[model samples]
Target chain A: MIDGYFSLYQTRSVNERKFSNFGKTEIGMQKTGFIPAIPDFTLTPRIDQVGAEERASRFTKRSIKKESKVNGLKLVLNMIDLTTLEGKDTEGKVKQLCYKAMHLHDALPGLPTVAAVCVYPTMVRTAKKALLDSGIKVASVATAFPSGQASKEVKIKDTKYAVDNGADEVDMVISRGKFHAGEYNYVYDEIAEIKEACGEARLKVILETSDLITFDKIRRASDIAMYAGADFIKTATGKVQPPSSMPVALIMLEAIRDFYYKTGRMVGMKPAGGISKAKAALHYLVMVKEVLGEAWLNNHWFRFGASSLANDVLMQIMKEKTGVYQCASYFSVD
Target chain B: MEKEIKKSSLSVSENGIEKKISPKRLEVLKTYKIYIGGQFPRTESGRYYVAVNAAGKQLANVCLSSRKDFRDAVVSARNAFAGWSERAAFNRGQILYRMAEMLEGRKIQFTDELMQQDVPKAKAEKEVNLAIDRLIYYAGWCDKYQQVFSAVNPVATSHFNFSVPEPTGVVSIIAPQEDGLLGLISVVAPVIAGGNTCIVLASGSKPLCAVTFAEVINSSDVPGGVVNILTGKVSELSSWFVSHMDVNATIYCEKDSTVQKMMQDKAALNVKRVIFYDKINWNTDEGQSPYLIMDTQEIKTTWHPIEHIAGSGGGY
Candidate 1:
C-alpha cells in the first residue's frame, strides 16, 4: 500500500516538473520582447501568501523515521554553518566554537563535521588557524551585519577585511530601510558591490526577513539578491525575533527554484536563526528537497546558520544510537 | 387535567398534527487523552487499549502510550524543573494544597471512576478521600521536610559544614497497578511537593482516575509539566522510564521482579536513583512519609573555611 502511494506521488511530481518547465518558458517568452541592459527588479513575481504558508507547513508533516531520520539528521549536521556572532566574541571563544564544529561528539564515531564555522571578521583569522587542515570552512558576516546602518565604504572595507583574513564565505545583510522604501536598485547595487569586494569568497546575502514583514517583500528581496550576484540568500542575521520562519524560507526557496528555471543558475538558500531543534532542521531539509529538488540537497547548496543546533542534532543522534535521551549537561557549551 | 394537557401538547406538532417523539439524546463520552506539558494530547502513536472493569465490561479507551510519549513528558518535566525547584518551599506547599482543593471538589467523580474499576462503593469513596488527604499531607511537608532532613555539623577544624536536601530533578514513575488512585497519589504528591517534576505512567487497568487526577492537577495552581501523566502499560514503558539519562530518578511500584531487575540493570547506564515500593500497601499508614520525598532528593554538603579558632582568642 505504501509503495503504491509513493508511486502515485512520484508520477505527480514528475508532471509538476514538466508543468513548471512550461510555465518558465512562458515567462521567458514574455520577457524577450522588452529585454533591457539591466534586469528590471520590479518585475519580480509576487508571492501567494496563503499558498506558500500551506506548502511550507506540509513539509513538517512528513514522518521521516528510523534509518531515514538518522540520515536526514546527519545531513542536517553536515549542512550547519556553526555560527558565533557576538560583540564579546574572542579568539578563545572562536577556537572553542571551531573545536565544537570539528568534534561535535567524539564519543560518537563516524559523525560528519559541520560544513563551516561562522564568525565575525576579527575572529576569522583565529577560526582559519584553528580549523586548518580540518576540511571545515570559515564564514564571516560582514557589510555591517544585523544592521546595515553604516556607510557603503565601511561595509566594503568590512568585506575586504574578512576576505583578507581568509574567510571562505561572507554573509552580508541587505539594507532593509532602503528595500522598505522601494529602492530595489539601491539594495541590488549594494549586494553587487559587496559581491565584488568579496574577491574569491562566496557571498551570502541576508535579507533579514523579520524586517520585511510580507512574503512579497521577502520574495522581491530574494530576487534582488540573486540577480545581484549573491551566491546564497539567507533569511536573517540571528539578532532579530520571528526570524527564519518556514514560510519565509519557503518563499526564498521558491525564489531560488524560479531563478534556477529562468537563468539556470543555482543560488544556495540559508534559513538562519530560531531553528535550533533537530526535528525543525529535518523539516527545513524536507522543504529544500521538495521545493528545489535533489540537486540542492548538499551543504554546498543548502545551509543552516545556527549556534546551538549542533548540540541538539548530536544529542538526537546519540539518542538514536543508545536508546536513551541525553541531557545538555553532558554536552559541551561552546 | 394539567398533566393530560401537557402530554397532548408534547405529542402534538406546531401544525397541530400528532407526532411520534424520539428518545432522549445520549450524552457523548469524553475521550481520555494523555497529559503532558500542561496540555492534554492524544498519544502521538494513535494507539489505544480498551480499559475494562473486572467484570469484563469495557470502561473506556485509554491511550496506549509509546516510548515517544514518555520522552516528550520527560522533556516537559526537565524544562519545568528549573522554575519549579527554584520556587519558595512555602509557595510549593500552597500549590500542593491547591491541588488537594481541586481534587476535593471532584471527589464524587473520582469515586465513580474507582467504582468502575470494581472497587466497592465505600472503598472507592475512601480511596478518593485518602487521595485528597494525601495531597494535603505532602502539602504540609513541602516546607518542613527540609528542616527535618538537613543537618548543621560541628567540625573539629575551623570550618563550618552543612548538608541540605535539594530536588534531584526530573523523576519518572511507574504507578502501582492494583490500587490505582491512592497509590498514584501517594507516589506523585511527595515527589512534586519537594519541588521535583515527574512523568508518571498511570495504571494500565485502572487508568480512569489517574487521568482525571491529571485534570485536577491541571486546574490547580500547580504549574504545567510539573506532573505529567501517561495512561499505558508499565510492562511496555518501564524500561524507557528507567533508562532515560535526563530523568534523575525512577520509582517503580509493581510486584513484577523481572521489571524490577530490568529497571535496576538499565538504570545503571545513567546511575539513576531507582526506588521500588512493591511491597507497600497503599491503605496502610506505611504509604505516607517524608522518606518518600527523600527518595527523590539529593543531599548537597558545603564546607566554608574559617580562620583558626586560636586566632580569635581575643574574643574568648
Candidate 2:
C-alpha cells in the first residue's frame, strides 16, 4: 500500500529537475551583478486550514512493513539532528550526545549514524572537538533562540560567536513580536543580516509557529525567511508547547514549493521538537516525498531536530530484527 | 402476567387504530473486553469467541487474545514493575485488602457466572467466598513475609552479612483450566502481594468470571498493569508466556505433561523460573500459603563493612 503511493511520485522527479535548473538560474543572476527586487511580503498566499490537515492525516495511514519499514526506519535515523538544548547543558553532556550521534547502538550491526548534533552556542566547541573525525556536523542554536528578544547587534555577534567556534550550521529565531506588530520588513532584514554574519556556515531560520498561532501567518513568515536567504526554515526551537505539528509543516512545505516555482531557488525544511516517535517521523517523510518529491528526502534538504527520536527509531529497527518488544533499560539514556 | 398484558393492550386500543405490543424486553449483555495498561480495549487482531452457558446458550463474546496481546501485556507489566516493587509493603497489603472489599461487594455476580459454567449454586457460593477470603489472607501476609524469609549470617570476619527476598520482576501464569475464579485468584493474589506484576491466561471455557473480576480489580486501589488477565487457549499462548526474555518466572497450574515438557525445554533459553501447581486443589486449605508468594521472589545477599566494637570486638 505504501509502495503504490511512493510510485505515484516517482514520475514527478523529472519535473523536479526542471525546478532545480530554474533555482540555479536565480542564483547565477545574483552573482552576475543583477539583484532581484524585494518581493511584496503582504501578498503571501493564504493556506486552506482544513484541506491541509486532511492531507496530512492521509500520509499517516500508509502501511510500510517488512523490508520497506526497516529501510524507512534507518532513513529516519540518518536524518536526525540529535539535539540537547537545555539550560543545564554541560560540556560532559555535549560530549555524551556527540558520542551517541556517531554510534547509535553498537549491539545492532550495520546501523547508520545521525546527520548532526545540535546544542547551545557555548557547547558547540565541545561538540565540535568530540565529533572531530566523524562525518556528523555540529549545529548550534543562536540569536536568542526560543525568544528573539535581544538587540540586532547582539544577535549578530551571537551568530558570529557560534560560527567562529566551528559550528557548521546556526539555527536562529525570528522576531515574532515585530511580525505581530505589523513590521514584516524588520523580521526580513534581521534574517538577511544573520545570513551574512554566518559567513561560510548555513543559517536555519526558526519561525516558532506556536507563537505565530495561525497558518496564514506561518505561511507569510516562511516566505519572508526564504526571501531573506535562509538556507533552511525550521518549525520550532524545541522549548514551546504544540511544537512541530504535521499540519503546520504541510503549510511550510507548500510555501517552499511555491517559492521554488517562482524564483527557481530551493530552500530546505526542518521540523524540530515534539516529534519523538518513529511512526510520526515516517508520516513526515511521506508528506515530504509527496509534497517536495525525492530531491528533499536526504538530510541535506530535510532534517528532524530531536533528542529522543533516535532511540525510538533504533528500538523499532531492533524489534523488526528480533521479533520481540524492547525495553528502555536496554538502550542508553542519552 | 398474561391478564395484565391483555388489559394494557385493550387500554391502548381506545384510539382509532390498534397497536401490537410485545410483553418481553431483551436485556443488554456486557461486552467482555480485555484490560491492558488500565484501559479496556478489544484484541488488536479483531477476533472473538463465543462463551456459552451449560445449556449451550451464548453468554457473551470473549476476546480471543493472540500472541501480540500477550506481548503488549508483558510490556505494560514490565513498565509497572518498578513503581509496584518500590511501594511500601504495608501499602501493598492495604491495596490487596481493598481488592477483597471490592470483590465482596460483587459476590452475587461472580456466583451467577460460576453457576452458568455448570457449577452447583452451593459450590459457586463457596468459591466466591474462598476467593475473597484468600485475598485477605495474602494481604495479611504481605508485610510479614519478608521478616520470616530474610536471614542474618554468622561470618568469621568483622563484617555484617544478611540476605533478603525481593520481587522477581514480571511473572507469567497459565491459570488453571477447570476452576476459573478460584484458580485465577489462587495464583495472582500471592504473586502480586509479594510486589511482582503478572500476566495471566484465564480458563478458556469459563471466562465470564475472569472479566467481571477484572472490573472489581479496576475499582479497587490496585494499580493497572500489575495484574493483566487474558481469555484464550493455553496451548496456543504457553510458549510465548514461557520464552519471553522479560518474563522472570512462569506458573502452570494444569496437569498436562506434554505442555510441561514444552515449557521446560523452551524456558531453558532464558533460564526462567518455571513452577507447577498441578496437584494442589483450589477448594482445600492447602491452596493458600506463603510458599506461593516465595515462588516468584529472588534472594539477595549483602555484605557491609563495619568497624570493630570498642570492647565486644564484634562478638555480639
Candidate 3:
C-alpha cells in the first residue's frame, strides 16, 4: 500500500509541470496528443464584471444614478388596537376600521386597495359589512387577541365564525404558550385546526415575532405555521412595539424560501402591526423582494396589515411622482 | 409558456378532485411496526410510542425500539450483506430502478404524507416527484459508478494492478431529524447504491413515512435484512451503532459536534470507517445527488499477471 502511495506520489511529481495553475494552462501540449492533466473547473461567464473594477466605476460617482421601475404595488394597511374591539365594542370598532379602510380605498382609487383589513373576530362581520362592494378584503384575527393562550376549539370556532361572517382571510395567532413551552407540535396543530376552519378563506398564521424573540424561533415558527397549512406566514400582530423588523422579516422569508424549495409551496407573507409608515412597509417589502423574489411581491402573496400605512404610502407615492412633499392633511383622509 | 400551461392544466385536471380535498381534511390513523432485519416485527419489548405529526396530532403508534431491537437490525444488516452486496451491480441497479417505479405508483400516498407534514399542495407534489426522480438517479448510478471511481495503473512492477469500488460492508446511519421523507431516502439509498447494507434510525415523530419507504424497499427486490430500520430515540440507539465492533462504517447526519465526535470515537474500536458528513448540505447539489455518497466507499484493489510465452517453448 505504501509502495503504491509512493509511486503515485512520484507520478504526481513528474506531472507537476502540467499542474501549474492547477492544470489550467495545458491546452497547447494537449494538441500534440499528450493527455493533459486538467483540473475540472467549469466556467460560465456572468453578465456583470467582478471585483474592484466594477466597484471603481460606481465609487467614482458618489451620487450613483439608481434606476428602478414600478411594477404592480399593493396598499398595506394594518389595523392595530384590536384589544379594545373584542366582545361588546368589537363590532363597532371593526366597523369603524372597515369604514376607514373603505373611505381610504375610495380616496386612493388610482392606487391598489390595501390587500386586507385585519381586525379582531367580533369585528369580522362589521368589516365585512362596511367593506361590502368596495373590493377591500376583510381579515379577522383569531386564536385569542394578543396572548394566543387559548384552546384549539376556541381558536377554530373564532376562525370559523370569522370565515362564516364573510372574512376573506383569517389571521390567527399561534399558541404562544405551547410555542414557548417548546410544544411546537401543539402550536402547529392549533394553526392547522384554524386553517381547516378557514375553509375557502385564506389563513394567515401569525407567529407574533416579538413573542418568538429569536431568529431561530421565528424560523421554526414560520416552518410550523407553513407546514400546518398557513396561506401566509405573518410576522406579528403589530401590538408589539417592534412589529416586524427587517431581520425578523428576513428570517421568516428565508424559512418560507426553504419551505418552498423543500415542499414546492409558495406561501404568502404579511408584515402586520408596527409598520406605521410607508418607508417601514417598503423596507419590509425590500426584504421580501430580496429573500422571496417577484413571486411574493403581489397582493396574493404579500401584504402589510397596517392602518396608518395607507396614508403614508399615498403621501410618498405622491411626493415621488409629482415632485412635491404632500402634507398628511393635503392627502384627503379616508 | 403555453405548453407549460397545457401540461399544468392536464396535471391539474387529473388530480382536481383530490386536490380539492386537502390531506389535512382527511385524517387517517396509521399503526406502525418495527421494520427490523427485513421483517415486520412488533417491538421485542412489545412497547410502542405514539408518533405525532407536525400538527401535534397522533398519526401513528410506532414501535418503541429497544437495545435488543437495535442489535437485531444490525445483525440482519450484517447477515444480508453477503447476498445483497454480492448481487450483480447491474441487478442491484435494476432493483433500485424498480423501486423508483414503485414509488411513482405511490406518489399520491406520499404526497398526502407530505401534506400532513404541512407541505403546501403544489410543493408536496414536487417534493414527492423529486424523491422518486432521486431514487431513479441513484439506481442509474449503482452500475456506472464502479467504472468512474475505479482505477487501473501502469505500474513499474510485473503484476497488473486494478482497483474496483466495493461495498464498505455493514453501515449504520442516523437520519436527519427533520425533512421527513427526503431525509430518510437521502441516507438510505446512497448506502445501498454502493452495495453496503445499512441499519438506519428513522426520523423521530415522522417514522410513518420511513416505514412506508421500507415497504417500497421490500417490494423493490432488496433482500430482506439488507436495510434494517429502527425508529426510536437516537440517544438510546446511537450508542449500539457506535460501539458495535461488527459495523464497518457509520454515516451520521446530525449537526451536533459532540455526538459526531463520540460516534467517531466509538467507531475506533473496530477500526471502522467513520464518515462525519458535517459538510454535506442537503440543500446543495451535492446533498441531493446520491453520487456524492457513492464516492465515500472504498475500492478494493486486486492484482493479476499478464503472461507472454515463446512460441518455440510452447512447441517443444
Sorted on DockQ, best first, the list reads 1, 2, 3
Best by DockQ: 1
Tens digits of per-residue lDDT, candidate 2, B99-194, equal 999999999999999998999999999999999999999999999999999999877767778999999999999999888899999999999999
Q: Order the candidates by lDDT, highest first.
A: 1, 2, 3
Model 3 misplacement above 4 A: A1-334, B1-28, B308-316
Candidate 1 chain B, which ten residues in sequence have the lowest lDDT sum? B1-10
Instruction: Give the per-residue Cα lDDT of candidate 1 at A135.
Output: 93
Q: Candidate 1 vs candidate 3: which has greater TM-score?
A: 1
Q: After superposition, how far is residue A277 of candidate 1 from its true place, in Å?
A: 1.4
- The better-scoring model by DockQ among 1 and 3 is 1
Tell me the lDDT of model 2 at B62. Answer: 95
- After superposing all C-alphas onto the true structure, candidate 1 shows an RMSD in angstroms of 7.6
Docking quality of model 1: it rates as medium
Which of candidates 1 and 2 reaches a greater DockQ? Answer: 1
